[model samples]
Target: MTIEQAIDSVKKGCKAKFDSTVELHINTNLDVSKPEQTIRVSVVLPKGTGKKVRVGVFASKNVETAAANLSESDIAKISKGELDPKKEFDVIIAEPRFMPKLAAAARVLGPAGLMPSPKSGTVTEDVEKAVEQVKKGKIEIRTEPNAPLIHTVIGKRSFSTADLAANFGEVMAAINQAKPSKAKPDWIKSVYISTTMSPSALVDIPDLA
Candidate 1:
């Protein structure tokens, strides 16, 4: 199916009571065992993710605007298992100064995938900008640890077909741009679009710009 048709198909197949997320999955030709062949980057969708992101910040300097601002003491508590970050925020951003302090909590945060890292734009000096990006649909797209698959959400079932298609295009464009220099032209083996509980719809690979 074309991208638009697949988006519409998935949207119609959604039976969830809530607005189900429209997810994009891609099977690639990359060899994940090679560090250079992995895909790990954050992208801001043009049409947004159609879901609100709860952003938390950890910084030495006070950032009143963060959804859940954590101090050095709070970091200590999280490190010691006295705090459960999963319950507090959907995304976490940290200032460079607080990174060392955050290491103690990596055991708790790393496995959860909420530990801030410069690679994902979740660790920075501009905490407010990072928060804004996450709130505005910035998402991390990465291939599976041992597989050649990439999975991430594009938008929601409630979004218009055009909006979903646009977001999908942006994701494909980003993936293409991030292709490993030595990868084959046909690096993307297959792509699928689906809703939270809907059957996946195979999609024709859209032409890359």
Candidate 2:
């Protein structure tokens, strides 16, 4: 389909207001080794999203429970007054000061968009919610600088085209709103949207005026 057709079909079928203009940022392509494309979005269905991720919290208490039991691929431990946040675990629990330790893993996790925080309720007094959301179909996204390659899912293929299109639009909006403070030099460089087996079809967003 033509780019305009794809955009219009997505907009109309989704019942979205025109305020959120469709966008197709340009002039960005980077080697996979060091992807210049910074933005990524991945979507998943509500039911078939796979096993829930187990979040291991590193806070107080003296239990030598097998770290293996932690639902995520890794585990972290933060002391009562530490000031560092390592690569974010599926869940995090520690003295607020230890948040800095995450600097080391920020480049790795931040770009993957896995750095869970309080706003998302991952860094809260109650660690259970963090665990719960991870298990649910919580779509994760990471945006590339200058490029619009958001890694997100549109859920199972059983979903109707309209559902996928509307879901896609919602995620794009979220990424646009989540621009980092450090990205002032040039927020977006290019746009590429596609699904699991498809080629990276370049995006052509209109001025919308």
Candidate 3:
């Protein structure tokens, strides 16, 4: 199916009262067995993800003060554990010095995909910048460690076709830029788009190229 068709299908099939997310599932030919083939990157969607992102920052005096000045509520949520990685915070940013503190919560944050990592642009000294980017719709894309599939939310089902299409194009461009040098021509095997609860619609891979 074409990109337009996929977006139309996803929007029409969405039945949720709240704005449901639209996701892109990509299957690549890269071998997951090779550590070098693992793909982890970030991209800012042209249209935001259509969800309010609650960001958490782990930092020392300077960074913490900067973060608190930006959003005191977010800092409180993190310190109070009210922003449970699994349920509250959408993304977590950490300064290098605070990496040790994160070790204590690794068991909880790791599995929820909320753990801050260098590859995901979440582990950095610039805690304030990272939080700002996330609030502005920066999203991380990573291939599953055990599989060649990469899944990420592109936008909301309520977005206009043009907006969704623009976001889709940006994601595809980022993926292409991240292509492994050792990967073959058919690196991207297939692409599919779907709403949070709807069946997926296939997107023409050739068109993406």
Candidate 4:
């Protein structure tokens, strides 16, 4: 189907009570067994992800204190488990030096996708900028470790068709830019868009091209 049709289908399929997030799913032709073919990266959507992101920063006290949005007190709260990683924050950003401290909470943060990593731009020297970017709708996109599919939220079902289409275009651009050197020309196999509880609508790859 055309991109506009896919977006319209996603909006129409949302039967959930809350504003369901519109998600983009891409299946690639990469071999999941090969480490070199793995895809992992982040991008800032132009229209934002249409989700409120609570950011947690792991950094030295000095850096936290210096940070404009993240405060030292907040870091302390996270470290002490006062702020539950899963419930309190949607994403976590950390400085390289504080990665060791973050390791201790891996069991709690890892499964929730709240762990900071270099590939996601969450592990950075510039903690303040990272936090700001995340607050402004920076999202990470990665192929599943065991599958060739990549999934990410593009926007909410409440968004207008134009807004969703714009966000969808940004995600496609980022995915194309992230094509691994080892991947073939037809690396991207299929793309779909859907709301949280709706069946997916297939998007025409040629139109996106």
TM-scores for every candidate against the unseen true structure? 0.94, 0.46, 0.86, 0.86
- Looking at model 3, residue 118 earns an lDDT score of 91
What digit string (tens of lDDT, one per residue) describes model 2 on residues 1-209? 44434544444444333222233323323332444335443333344233334445534332233122222223232232232333434434332433466544455555544465655544554444434555565555654544444444444334454554555565556665554444544544545444333334455544211
Writing each residue's lDDT as its tens digit, candidate 3 over 133-163 gives: 7877899998997899999988887789999
lDDT winner, 1 or 4: 1
The C-alpha stretches of model 3 lying farther than 4 A from their native spots are 61-83
Off by over 4 Å in 1: 206-209
Scored by TM-score, the top model is 1
- lDDT by residue (tens digit), candidate 1, 1-209: 88888888888888899989999999999999999999988889999998878788987666666778888898888888888898888899998998888898899998888999999999999998888888888999988988999999999888899999999888888888889887888899899999999999999865433
In terms of lDDT, the poorest run of 10 residues in model 3 is: 64-73
> Per-model C-alpha lDDT, please?
0.88, 0.43, 0.81, 0.82
- Where does model 2 exceed 4 Å of error? 1-54, 58-121, 144-149, 180-190, 207-209
Per-residue lDDT, model 2, residue 72, is: 20
Cα lDDT, model 1, residue 21 = 93
Candidate 2, backbone clash total: 33
Between candidates 1 and 4, the one scoring higher on TM-score is: 1
- Model 1: how far is 81 from its true place, Å? 2.0
Q: Measured by TM-score, how close is model 4 to the native structure?
A: 0.86
Instruction: Give candidate 4's root-mean-square deviation (CA, Å).
Output: 3.3
